[model samples]
Target: MPGEDMAGGAADTGPEEWADARLRGGADAQAAQDPPETVRHTGPPAPGMVINARYELVAPVGHGGMGEVWKAYDTKLRRFVALKGLLDRNAMTGASQAEAMARARREAQAIAKIEHPNVVTVHDQVETDSQVWIVMKLLDARSLAEVLRSEETLTVPRAARIGLQILQGLRAVHAADVVHRDVKPHNVVVGEDGQAILVDFGIATFDGALAVTQAGAVIGTPEYLAPELFDSSAHGPRTATPASDLWALGVTLYEMTEGRTPFPGPNAWEVQVTIDTSPVPPFQYAGPLAPVIEGLLTRDPRQRLNAPEAEAMLQRLLDPRAAIAPTPSAPPPEPDPVPVRRRAPRGRRAGALALGAVLLAGAGWFALPLPGDDPDEKDGKRAGSGGSGTRERWKDTHPLLKIGVKDDQPGLSKFDPKTRTYAGYDIDLAYEIAERMGYARDEVDFTTVATDYRSTALKVKLVDLVIASYSITEERKTAPPTGYSVDFAGPYFEASRGFLVREKSSRYDIEDTSDLQTLQVEVCTARDSTYEKWLPEAGFKLVESPPNTYQDCLDKLLDRSSDIYAVATDDVILAGYVKENPGKVRQLENVGGAEGYGVGMRPKSPLLKSEVCASLKDIMSGQVWEDLYRKNLSPLTDRKNPPGLPDLTECEVQSAGP
Candidate 1:
């Protein structure tokens, strides 16, 4: 009872959320178990305090981070309702207040858009001069928190029924790619008729937005937070995925049947570590409801039961004739053991399969030290580190990535127009990125993209990832919507600027860097190429003719329309022209470059960069990258050893400053 108020942490609703840590667990938890702070008579509101002229506040039922919730009467419709709106709007400064306002409206609109019985109905959201009020269907109810405090532990059948309804609501939320990051008993309201409705999306988040919580902190209750939350920091930005929510669901169900939370701690960090390390205790009273609970509670997001799978598992439990058996199929061989010490016992949940524990024991997870808590570091690794949940998130939405590869170019990504096939190191690298991102080869759909259209295709999202020997320049990377506004996976291959010109052309008269100023070399360059910036800076006042591709430059050179076929592209690409055209065109000699080839993606996608860089680094560390280079670029290399892998450090996204 001493730490009960502290244990029930408030759900944070952006900058507009009520500014108090004690107001945790959005609704009843903040009022019932914790201090009321300065809120007066949180019992019933005065009759005359109407909100937005449409709903009259009858009583203050509950309140939390997203301000006060009232039991109200809709004056227009003459029906009972719940009124939820932000707090201290005028107190907040400009941008912070605006973002919170947008977040509130977004949550209201998203939940209202979905039609599901288990989810509460959002009727309308009205913005006033000072505040915003969201009107929702009001149910005459005592919360699950009230039931838990009174009943202690629920019967197995009752808990399952409650969990089933909650899962249905979760399915609907996840279908919209939204995550209710703080799902606890406090957020659930059990109506008088025994219907449990999920409510309060104050901390609910969509995949499109970059970060869920603030930089260094996680928003949910300490006990219900998943182990994966510990892995994320400002260093490794983490968004809330449904898998994290499912972990909360498991904890909620556990609390319903067990009376006390599975992991009890005086502080939030200890609770997180306990979740990551300690064994999930056996379900004593949750008879047939054990498998899904254990499955959903796993630290590894990949192994955790997803929304659809968890829904199906819960559905089978509801049907009396189809009681689930843990191992309906034959037992398989034991998995190979993991490096981390698996000291926790394998408590029984489902039948003999012990699938969750057996796999968890061999899971081989890592945990890092949090500054002052750095322990005796051993074997160059730390215990209780968190896992990245990005792969599981991608599987739900964009498992099949549309990759942009050059259709006609050789050596990098080449697509045969007539044969309709793609081959080259860039194509191989794209498939490798998909593989490390938890996708199979067939899951990738390759599209033909010329060099000029690469940036455009990625900007409009016609392609999810592009690996067509793209350059990594500061200008392209900094360009807002059209350029490197997205993340880059590599400098997987490095190249310097070079020109492909005819042997008989006057371009050979250029001896050194200083000669570029005097040479009136009429250079044909590609549109959107970095040379547009690079050429003038390097003192080349050459008359520029922009084309769609370097191939077009070669065409102009061969047709005698241009004095010099010029480009500032990878040496491998210039070599391709020389290899294909015999003596017709040759690369400019002694011209070295400071550029690297990169895999490009949308601006705000962190996972694309994280997983892509992970895969690129992994392949380069082993024989895989060398083999890829030998297979595709070896022809261009003329059987010589192709360039060693680009420096791994070049591909990494620099950690934000502390």
Candidate 2:
């Protein structure tokens, strides 16, 4: 039914009509008084025909398989509106008449509940003269089907703009618990002002409504159906979800840009088979928008890009700076390789050790200074060496750059004992910044730091930089007596605060912090960390004694005897724990506000902090940041929609001084 010529109007085949009839009632029913052949060939309604004493039909505009649309004047509202009624009920059996009426009522109900600018507005629904009619707002617009038939294709920017508006409308529909199963070019109308409005929700599914069609009956246009709706064995059942609508939207976008759907065939069955077995064809004209299309076209619904992620990508395409740049014919030469050097071990423990060792060794290490500490030293060799000093002096005095990091977090930062090397997102980022600052790879030292000691380690000059998933906060930036007085550079990574619970706790349906409070679940978080302050603010019940590190909280969660039901921290940190434990734990993301992880430094190193901030900005703007994320966190997190690069406006302000 979907692959038919839809340039003029929708034309349902015999099977689709029969499926609709079965949805209303059985096929054994009386026929209309008029003969079927006579009703099928009846002339259009006259231009001056009046309907329901409130509408005057001006002219017939279009005809569909089940109904016909008319440009009519609403006398009661003193405006013009689109009127739709059964094309010819007398031409079919009694069951077909009932099916057409039911479809009209369902369409009216679905569109009336959604009041977005991009969605069509419904005025009223009435039954008169043995015909069901729906009244809706009229526009000087044409269906996208007609436009596509004439123009063949559209520019990428224009298509993206239209796709974005449709996505917004779909989001509102989903928020109301409705799914538009029929989202194709035929259902979209583009006005003279270039505003795209989604119309025709005739086959939409409401949350609590009964099934409109019987089991195993194909509902949507075959060319636009999602992969899951084709074969129940390969990908789940044929049940429709919001993601199904997104998949249809992806097909529509592909058609708009390429002048044809990705899976093309001579017939509907062939198209369905191709969609089930073939990958999306490579793009020829879709340059920057290719990724968005690929994200939507992912066969797995779980990994496909959601509405918000798709909308963000479309918005980025609208930005002028996001235009594609021309590539050079020759490849750029690679940089000279930096020599490797064995790292000298500091007194602090490495993060690759056992959790018990971390809990015991990291408890009171921050209270005492390192063995070679000298309070009066200002030559940049010991603790507080560069206090209130110049960048040139600090760089000249320190031959090797020392960076404080966490070793236990699997994806963010982890230490491998077998290879005796540090690897993960933060590790790669540390190397990126160091290279940008004129330091060789072997000239850098990574020392494991506990969560609560990040700022103190920077203030005491235990390390030149702290990249241990350290969050930027006002309390940490303020001078001593009130706060830690630590300086922060770029917020290189953006993550949300969330909860990590054992898989068994999923039965509680704990979606957010409020759910945890209502369930009286005891939560555990690292002491002196940001979650320590946020947990009480969120009204969560904390354990009698909090853990000293994230791993300690995770340990408590793994122990059956412990009272901890969930571990609270940034989602990035929780992702690591989930990856390590596998099916044992899962993260509940976005339970709290977003937290930006920054590079922490001593407050006195202003010039050096500025340099690091600039380096971070460069890394985010290039492909290096995305490559690092894919290598480390993408497997554990949402690979289709990774976190966006954070805005570094604060870095500019900090660099300009107070």
Candidate 3:
């Protein structure tokens, strides 16, 4: 209802209105503290004042946790525009100011490129009397938040219509590879002309970009948050897919129809609890529209109804279709329960051993996980909840800790099928972790995992941990957190992504090809790299290939099939291959990307994450981390200025809250 809040709350900087508080517990409570009529009015540009010489502010429209929304007139265009500016811009300094500026820039960048009939349009971002302002499309219509606030609830057909329109905007947003992280009712504007527009790209996440969030929490409204978001269990990287946004859409529909939040609670944390553990309550008023709501609200992201699917269902409601499922003659057979199997790894290189640099603390050195245990919960309560749980029984049942590593990665993990042995930086670190667990090198089991399949292995309990060069991203962390059931630890190493080309091929070199928009070169990269998704959008003629492994991409370049290979992955990986191939391949020093290597684990292993995080921090800060780098990666990397590892603080479990 207030102006699109990309900058954080008054207390902190980030998209505050719904960004930080919805993820942690801020906005609503913070707003309640301040009276509704409160206007920051800290400095210049009072009502009717002109800003940036062109826009004349008619009046202050609304004020909330984020900033202030102003109704203004664009003098040049002779049309109205919403001049959104920060309330406390003139009064802030230090980190807060820097954070606000970053959020503002991010919002402008995110929305400026998008053009959809159902999305709010951004005209320009300008500096007005020392305060930054974003000029956006003005809508005289009431927000969906206001609509509900005025008339408690809407009929099923009306709710369905609004949802369908929202889905149309979402289709365009996701098509542009953006995840509208915040999708609450307040952000949706419904015009009097019957047009519904999805507004606020302030917290939307694009590929390779991290959403600025409250330091220890997810960044979205907890009530509308998908169950996958409440996943502290899988302490790994979080990713929010299209289904996540759809889940919020489902929540919005429910709220519109029922006049209340589907998962209602006084606090964000309590809302998360209900979403994670509770089943969907029957919507008495839903009638024929019940199926759409239930399908979209499914807990498991994998099984949840997607945007297109929900769109079709809502479309059917808007324009009734003849399609209907006939009643089954008999009850369907129950799906076989998936068994959690923990076993001693198969196909071991017998007698292969590693030495733990030190002895473990004691029998309790390993993590003891309490399933569904909230990080904020007391230890005593967790201890008494589950008797001899899986974490507790890990040692007794499975003697060795099963760790998954990549089969072909050079510097990270390289498995030798002939010798049945594993080597490289990841292997060494796994041994280091195992030693800390009071086990011999052979006591830990090693399993081969493909890059894309690692999440599955961890989810199914096929592996206890993954030490591959996995880049810990916001998307990976939140992508169906509860459903995937995995955790992450230690960014023990930091690498940069760069381009590799033949030494003589000046045309494919980074220096030779500056402008991507006008460039004429073919680019090939590994299938799993994020660059594969965003590169074409940036104007690169990508070479598609079957089985896009790092080796495959390299082979394509060597075979003269592709002019260049662009992988936003480990620089050391490219370095190793380049060195081995001599003058044939060279890395483009200018093309660089950040790639932090973190270890992956399964859900319900917060203690494991905590323990691994400590080890990773030690490996990152202490001499052991350096020694491993020198021994395994230094020969191929830039030894003089080796890349520094990322801060493991982000991976640390926040027992308190975001």
Candidate 4:
């Protein structure tokens, strides 16, 4: 009947292709048939028919995946509300009907628990004549899907505003520990007042609650599912999180701007595979909101922008001043053209006397002048006529960019010996900077640097740059007993201190700093890292022998007999380790002191420092930085706090420098 023509004839095709098709219609779509039903009702209710006694169905207004809606009058309340019940319940037989009815009731229950303007409100639910009925606040609105159909695309600002509201609703839903498993444009309604409201909780579920759908069944629209839901081999069975809803929201936003979804294929399987394995297609019209869309669509649910993070990004887009970096009005320009020049020898170090003078000057130290510091230096050459004053740009002098990085950090940085390749956030970032600095991918080399040796690597010219998770501190900028006296550029990333504990260990429940103090947990962190100073000051006990790297701490945590109750480090770092050893390790929700990661270089190379800092600033303002972050870090953690562009004021070229 659902696929019938108005003339009471069987149509050639089912309503499955209709834009408003309520039932799942993808390739794998399936619904269990209901058991034979007992006589429940004589016929469908007409206008003014009071089947529930207290309410009368005035007219059918719409239908959803599992139910039909009607404009109804509440006789007792003396007001009108929207009422819902299983779609053609009497006509449906067997398990399919039962599941639909159950889902309808579940929707009622889920909406009733959340009270937010952006979320639909449930007023009453009742059972009459063996059918479940839900009463809800009537809203004068149209589904976003319908709006998009008429208006092929919306401006970036409008899409961001709508996305912000949806994200707000999601926040409230997640606060109640619920996951709106089916988040799509059809599930979002835009009201006459221009306020967007999230609706239809038919497939929503409480966190940790047994799923209402059949096991291993792929639910929701195929195009909107996060990678984890469909990619069985890579991510395993579906484990929906609030992050999943964000992914759907990302797709919805993409559609609002691009006039279509990111992944398009002839069949559902192909689309699913694309979503699981491929990067989001490049945006042609996303404009300033591209980063927000990219952040939301990250395949790694953990690395994906959470509700709060997404909301902040949207809010910033609406108010540009608050944005991490003012988004470019157009796509960023191509990489700075590389200059054709003779290559300098590898491990070429600047004069030691120049670096020593800057470092030995103590806390207020500054770069020293070189022969090329004359004011007349211009057109890529020195001011004076003599060859002695011929200035060399840092890129020309260092044709090969030698970067020191952590080989053990899982998501932040790691080396795969089998493939003889380095991969992770640090690795990707180094490559990005190198490209901007006019170096080819092959011209860049990565050297593994231990936590204690990051500065030494730079000081001794073992590496031209240290892109390891090197935190910037005043002590590190000063010379001698108190510090490494290393100069830094562009705090490219901001990391927060948090703890990682064995998932199955029952010795302690560390949720926050208060728990750490109460449980007297002995935490292990990488030696000479920020955590070493923060933990001891926060009253956390450190293991007698601290590990040389976060990986070592994770190893100690995995050993059942070790006294190390937890491993503490930047949440970004811990997230990777947790992902690398899933189920065996988990990060505590507690986030402590924050630190900004910077690129470490020798104190004398002010020219190179300025170049790297400028390159980082440019990258942060574009989509590539967001892409790199999503690729390397998003798959590791779901913590709501997302790092923004670091303040580049520290990157100002010192007047004392050549």
Candidate 5:
């Protein structure tokens, strides 16, 4: 087994002897590549002289596409280490070989110079008669890809955090002008401490060495390659851009979230075409992972969110009410407790620039009022504080906190008679937050928008949070950098944009959406916005029209104004308008697959937001969360009840409380 572990100990035989035996025994294809003597050296190196006796190879740890990795002991320092070797045949070729060696040397230099927790530190690089090797810190855990295969699946937030950590490492590499062109699951090794250590920069190249690659030799795994790889440029399949790594990361995320790649095929070629030509499947069928997939799979590179953007989304998904604002470690207080200043007005560009800088510097706390009733009571009130005091007082009462959800209905905030207030799932979540913060349910203002306005509303500061079952992903989070924040909760309900046709309509015979032809599509404004980017890529003609709520779409179907109603199933289920409506509506059997719903918030609202997250966590800790489901959402519960945990203690609530 090529991947099997080679345990600790000294073999009585030398490298050449073992290699000859293995070759004669016909060991694996990998063994066939190594000369018998090289194969003998494959196992942990027996005591050996290296670089005039400064270092020694102790054991072989692992092997990959390029070479074998060894666990070595540094004789001078009395410490353990990892040594990587490049023994691939092409490394000994002509000019291409020299270019490869130069690239390898650059990667070694880059890894050695950089210092980051997530990045594996390369200690030294050395070349032997038959190999090029890099000495690095020995990692104790398996590759992340292996860990995932063993563990099967991880919670969305958990996986996202791991991904963000990996991105952070990649960011450092990119900062050094190194693109980890081979970013993939196997390259990320999970250490014993549960941190992700980015490893194997074997094919990584500095920006200066991008031209080293030969045509037709893809530097990355086909499944993870970016669509731009198909571009007939000198730069291999996918051009080696920092963004290309991000795209691979997106594919990694999609696979982890959904338990399968967004584009799957029997072989790599089919997958490559799908990557370059197909739209990512909707995440609605992904259950709890829906929001995570959407965020990571955004197609546009500029729009592809990276570490900082991903960190925000992960933190939110993990703890929704986490302060949306970036919380850098606070600095020491200003001398003599000078009164805090106000954000400069936008009229003076310098003032706005300074204000923005101050906020980013974590001095925004000085601009926001502390948890106090009035500013006049502070000792510095007399020090030209009136102007700042008035604004701070007003802001305390009217914190720019708000949530905008996507709704196409004429009156989205209709009161629910069953719950005795505005009580859709989205409303309930938002209402609970507002109620705890001393606002009547109705005090939380409602603003309706088409799907496209979702990002715009957040960017313009028209909304502080969006709880309208929005799908969260890495791509969307980066759309308006520092504008929107997504923290996912219970995916609560499943939703997707699928075709619904009249039972008697001529197109009713159309089974899957792919089967429909020359058809008029009736879509709610919200559904249209989501599908506009996805459906056309899937090859469908989208008939643009005025926005309609799910109920309106159903009505239009009965009236025969449109041929098919494409809408989210949740809206369809909630509207109850599709119930036995003269056989006018039936969801396509294999149409839109799975997608999920999540809460979205502005990037800056941390105060009440963290509190809201605490409340949700609190609810999820006990039967209250499950009861919300057992009462209202029976269809979603697992067939076998998940084993219950210890009951929530008062301290748990207090500790978890925002």
Candidate 6:
């Protein structure tokens, strides 16, 4: 076989050359495939060395702008692995190889620190033949870019949920003070298990450290570059901040919903300039995502909304009563057809009939069916003719004080055998409130409620309190189930329903309605507050699934079946993906508005409300709430925990937007 056989026109070479061209960017270059230089490699298996104490010399996986990644297997581990070789191989002069090797080691160490469900794992790193070899978890999936090229855009809700997961991955890395300077679609991985994992921390930088990039040596793919990354002055004299990552995330969402970047140009330089100077337009998307996108893509990084604010915004968008603007679209033209129409009947007649008994009953009205009550259960639960006897039962033990939790949310399990206790955030919180009311934890009965049936259980008095990360809304507050009123506690943790996609996605530039026809968007559900109201108004033909959580949508995006996913902004599920695969999934921007998680009690239970609120006040004012907040949210919130807005901490702040 020719040396350049698989190198792509990489050598003006053929099919194999196609692979090489993909790696090197051209035919005759010898340097790695970095921009401005295209390099191709002659086939060769290095002559000396032991890998996993077996599997002798083999050829390179392929060469690229950065370096060459080899495909190999470990005889001992009995699995395939990818080994990455730095840009310069045996040709390094002096101690450069050693320095590169050190860098490789540092990268491995940094990767090791990240443990999440969506991150790719690093297995080993070694110095061989004057070159550095970094072995990483192998994946059978195609590059996110290739997948997008084939599948294009994904649904909106799916994109939003996936976006949230990506933020999670970034949160882990950011918590370690590392910045993934290069975030875009190509770096994300959609695993066989259908989760988007962030991969390739090759260009990541530690916060506050001198940039490894030389002057005029811009890093990262062009499309997802934050305006600040391109021109620090563009974002008020800052080079890049955590907010920059969010700006890039906004671009990613744009690409997913519009099927193209919000800013596009013929060349990288032009694209970078556009990114730095241009502004994203206001356009509605298939749900209530416009506001969410606006916050994510804000050019002024400082003015842009933070993750918590974004998360809260999304929760509100998830509300069912949040009205969506109607989709503005031209009516379909009348079809050309053959005319064989039928005429209407010319006449009709009717005769009045007399009743045999000639008896009339009084006219009466029937009430409309209430939301959660089944007809069968309603009749049986009706108050007895002896009203006084029934009233006492409802008033004393306070049947309304009983709180119920739904099983749909994660970490809400009833009990764990290993722990031998009722474990989960909700379980603990609910029991704490009950204890404050002077009731034993056991007094708060546990009954598994499916997410679909949760509301029904509430209407029937099956449970008194619901602490299942539920948000209190005006609609639910106004007309509650008979005798029940809705009361809330501290917003606690904030969250949102936003978009998730590959970091460098073309959708990054999508900030308006100017480009909606080219993308494929997936949504979690049609009833999702954001998408239901916004997508139609923005003029999108939405493809939605039955009601599902953010994670469900994430799984779809990772499978490459959906381009975008929607979920709580606070979810930051991307952390799991990054942990599972390493640096792939990411948030484009928050697609919705601020919403809070609160303790829901029947409005009728003033005693419960006052008692629970007092406990909350103490917690919020003291170390207990801080400890809990730190425990569950330190990864992302510790650094920027919002200060003293006791009133706004978990409460909704209404704002007007286009």
lDDT of 4: 0.67
List, residue by residue over 401-480, the lDDT tens digit for candidate 3: 77877756776677675566778888999888777665687678676655554665565344578887777776677764
lDDT of each: 0.62, 0.68, 0.62, 0.67, 0.52, 0.48
Candidate that beats the other on lDDT, 3 or 6, i.e. the better one? 3
Sort by lDDT, best first: what order?
2, 4, 1, 3, 5, 6
lDDT, residue 427, candidate 6? 67
Q: Which lDDT tens digits does candidate 6 get at residues 1-658?
A: 0010111112122234323444464444233222332222233345222443432223454554545666554444444466666434544456665666666566556766776654556677665555555667666655555545665655444455456556666666766766776666766655433455666666676643444566765566667776676665444543556777777777776665556778887666798777556777433232334445666676655445455444433332332122111111221122223221121122311110011011111111111122232332323233232355653122234422356554334343333434434445566666666665667654555544333333434543445566665655665467433223355666654565444455434444443223332453443432233344455565444554333344445565566445553322234333333334345555544544555667765444434444567666655666665555444334442333533434534333211110
Return the number of clashes found in candidate 2.
0
Question: Which number leads on TM-score?
Answer: 4
lDDT for model 1, please.
Answer: 0.62
TM-score of each: 0.44, 0.48, 0.45, 0.50, 0.46, 0.43
Comparison by TM-score, 4 against 5, better one: 4
Per-residue lDDT of model 4, residues 61-164, tens digit only: 66655556767655555555777664456546776666656655665566678888777777888866546777777766677887788877775556776787
Candidate 1 structure quality by residue, lDDT tens digits, 251-355: 999888667788877767899778767888755455445656776776665345555445545544444223222221221222223222212334543432344
For model 1, the superposed segments whose C-alpha errors exceed 4 Å read 1-47, 87-91, 207-212, 233-236, 320-658
Off by over 4 Å in 4: 1-47, 86-107, 276-278, 323-658
Error of 5 at 421 (Å): 32
Model 3 stretches with alpha carbons more than 4 Å out: 1-45, 86-92, 95-99, 206-210, 234-241, 320-658
Candidate 2 lands at a TM-score of 0.48
lDDT of 2 by residue, 1-658 (tens): 1221111122121233322332344332112111122121134566656677667666566665545677765655545677777334545466665665565566566657887877777788876645767777775667888778887776656677778778888888887888888889888887655677777665677765556556766777777887777767765777888888999999989888777889877655787789767888755445446656776786766445667556645654554212112121221222123221112234322321233233323432111122233221433233233356744433455556778888779889887766657889999999999988888888787766677656655543556899988888888788545235777887888888889988875346666667788998988998668888788877888776565478889998888777788999988889788888988888875664888888988775655676687789889999999899998999878675567888875587643231
Model 6's TM-score against the true structure? 0.43
Stronger candidate by lDDT (2 vs 3):
2
lDDT (C-alpha) at residue 262 in model 6: 82
User: Cα lDDT for residue 613, model 5?
Assistant: 58
> Number of clashes in every candidate structure?
13, 0, 21, 11, 23, 122
Question: Once all C-alphas are superposed, what RMSD does model 5 give against the true structure?
Answer: 23.4
